[model samples]
Target: MGGFELTLDTLRDLAEGAAVLGTGGGGDPYVGRLLVEQQLRAGRAVRIIGVDELPDDALVLPCALMGAPTVFHEKLPGAAGIVTALRTLEDRLGRRAAATMPIECGGFNSMIPLVLGAETGLPVVDADGMGRAFPELQMETFAVMGVPGSPMSIASDHGDAGIIDAVDNRRMEMLARAVTVQMGGSAYICDYPMDAREVRRTAVPGTLTLAARIGATLRQARDDHRDPFAALTAMLADTIYSHGVVLFRGKVADIERRTVAGFARGRVRLTAMDDPGDQMEIVFQNEHLVARRNGQPAAIVPDLICTLNSETGAPVTTEALTYGQRLTVYAISTPRIMRSPEALACFGPAGFGLDDPYVPVEQLVGGP
Candidate 1:
């Protein structure tokens, strides 16, 4: 299929779908949905193109928000920040951007590129660095596949901006995080500046479109009075994320979230509704990292650990999670590219400082 236009009607699906793929991070997409809506309302258009559609030499600028997700709920970002960040990066590179793409297939991050596209009339590529949202900048397929994340530019809503040309990808994350903290805990960033050739080689393809498809499936299931979780897993069956499983169904027993050192660090405990003694715990640093079911590893990164509303099947971001809420937690296996040694070494359990080794969710659950 070719590229499609993002109409107002479709924005809802894209936002909701991206949230599902966000894996309990990426901030809330609702703020981004409003931003995109405002843009579309003003008669601007946001077009999405597949990676194959990009010219080999096309300069693609990938953008995202960096900092604690919880801070974003209060210090909201605006279009000007991203636009400014893009221009600042282009000025540093001495070339104009041919197009914009997301650094990750996250709720707000996915939509931010669309905001840039709508503002600049540049087509947004339908791919991203990470197939799912990650907490750190270096935890990306692009980084693992040899893309330098330096020459990065960050901007705040107040118009403050800075560029960091780090020596390495990990350094880039460190320096960027420091700046994001100074920018009031959250900031928009343009990084991983690369040509379309590198993008096609390193990026996770079709993530934006895939997110829209997932959103539509969940909406249809709910409208038809079908089981949305079943529908969601069924739809994911044919995708790159070929395996998915409902790990636990319970109420939030306890939550401890805090903004520390530019990241949202926390853990949540869940008690099984039928058997209170049976419990699950998930630890996160900006994004959900590892989930332990009764003190055993149920899912670990680079696989996705997502939380959803038990009754509505809507995704719940880590910032929005509250105590006593009934939620369904599920895990989706990462694509092969993300499971390779290089990829795992970048975002595996050890990368997040966890003791559990990298284990595919499919293996842990037996199968999808």
Candidate 2:
């Protein structure tokens, strides 16, 4: 298949699938779905091209919304913000962006670039830096592969915009976070400019298609009166992820959420509905980092820890968690690229202030 024009129906599927990949972070896909739906209704075309099909010299820009996901719930951005950021970056680099791609394939970031592409008349490359969502900008495959994250542009819905030329990816994230907070907790950014060759090497291939396929699989399972979770696991195991399973099934008992240092920091406690004494806890700094059951680590970062509504099989975002909600937690292995020593150092449990050693989700779950 070459590429296809994005429609409202496909966007809804992408949003649902992205929320599952988001690992309880990357902002709300519902908001993203609404934004992209608006663009489609306005007669704009958003096309998704496979990354391998991009010209070797094509200029690709990765764009996303940055900051606390909670903030986005209250403050919606004007489409102009993403346009401004992309245009600002293009002007700064003295070259036009040939295509746009998502910085991450999970949550709102997966769909945000589609909106930009539709608005800017640029096709979106069907790939992303993180096959899943990550809290920090530096924790992407692009950064892990030595791609510079500088010469970036950030813009707010209020017509404020700024450019950053950082020495490194970490500095880029630090600087951007400050600006994001000042912009009322969220902003749009275009960063990690690269040629098609670099994109092919650093990005997770076909993630946009993967997200869509996942959504379609789940929808079909639900419609056929089959077990959606079983179908989801089968689909994930057939992909680069290679492993997927429900780690816990319970009802939320307590939740502690706070905006700390410009990030949504929180923990969720769940009690097993079948066994009240059995409990599971998930910790997060935007994206889920660790999950423990009865104080024993069940899953750790670099691997995906996702929450789904038990009854509906719908993905749930961290900021949307509420007490007494029935949910099932799934643990899927990270892409092989993300499990490398270098990549782990950047986004593992230690990176999130957890002293736990990195463990594969399959190992923790006693094989898939």
- Computed on alpha carbons, the lDDT of every model, listed in order, comes to 0.91, 0.90
User: Per-residue error at 221 for model 1, in Å?
Assistant: 0.7
lDDT string, candidate 2, 293-358, tens digits: 999999999999999988768888899999999999988888898989988888887777789999
* Residues 64-120, model 1: lDDT tens digits: 888788887898888899999999999999999999999998767888998999999
Error of 2 at 288 (Å): 1.0
TM-score of each: 0.98, 0.98
Give the Å error, residue 45, model 2. Answer: 0.8
Worst 10 residues of 2 by lDDT: 359-368
Could you list the CA RMSD of all candidates, in the order they appear?
0.9, 1.0
TM-score of candidate 2 versus the correct structure, residues matched by position: 0.98
